[model samples]
Target: MANFFTTALFPVMNQYFGMPVTFLIHGVICLVYFFFVKTSVPETKGKSLEEIEKLLQKG
Candidate 1:
């Protein structure tokens, strides 16, 4: 959304900068995704389906 608006609102943005604002936003998003996966995204660290269901019900 921010990228789209940035490009659309500033007509010369793509011409002057190349690869539209979306490219920069995409790069940032990719960096964040890599960082998140490296630091936070869990590795399916859970138990069986039945156990998960039981815990969900208790919660």
Candidate 2:
């Protein structure tokens, strides 16, 4: 599913924005995703199912 969008959008973005700009855009997107996961997702390492569920339910 992700590949489908990447294949479709990459060429158009590259054509209009050029390679460097396209990569910078992707970099910004990755930074946004990093922050979102860092803040919004819970850490589940060594945690039990019940604990994880409680964290999600609290949200």
Candidate 3:
């Protein structure tokens, strides 16, 4: 669904902003999304399943 929407919208975005601006817009959006996910997600390296389950259950 998202792919289709982006595919359809890319032409309109490119038409108004041109290819270079469109690519820059996408790159910025990807970087922002990456940072948001990286900060918001929890890290559970080497944690046991029971410990992970307890952590999730607390929420």
Best by lDDT: 2
Q: How would you encode candidate 2's per-residue C-alpha lDDT over 1-59 as one tens digit per residue?
A: 64587678889999999999998987887788899999988899999999999988998
Model 1 steric clash total: 0
Q: What is the TM-score of each predicted model, taking all chains together?
A: 0.37, 0.86, 0.68
Candidate 2's C-alpha lDDT?
A: 0.88
Local distance difference test, candidate 1: 0.66
Q: Write the per-residue lDDT of candidate 1 for residues 1-59, one digit (tens) a residue.
A: 75586557455655666765646866787698789888764443568887767766764
Candidate 3 residue runs with Cα over 4 Å from true position? 1-4, 44-49
Pairs of residues at least 3 apart in sequence or in different chains that clash in candidate 1: none
Question: Residue by residue across 1-59, what tens digits does model 3's lDDT show?
Answer: 74686788899999999999998988887788789879876667899999888877886
Better of 1 and 3 by TM-score: 3
For model 2, the run of ten residues with the poorest summed lDDT: 1-10
| lDDT (CA) per prediction | 0.66, 0.88, 0.85
Scored by lDDT, model 3 comes in at 0.85
Better of 2 and 3 by TM-score: 2
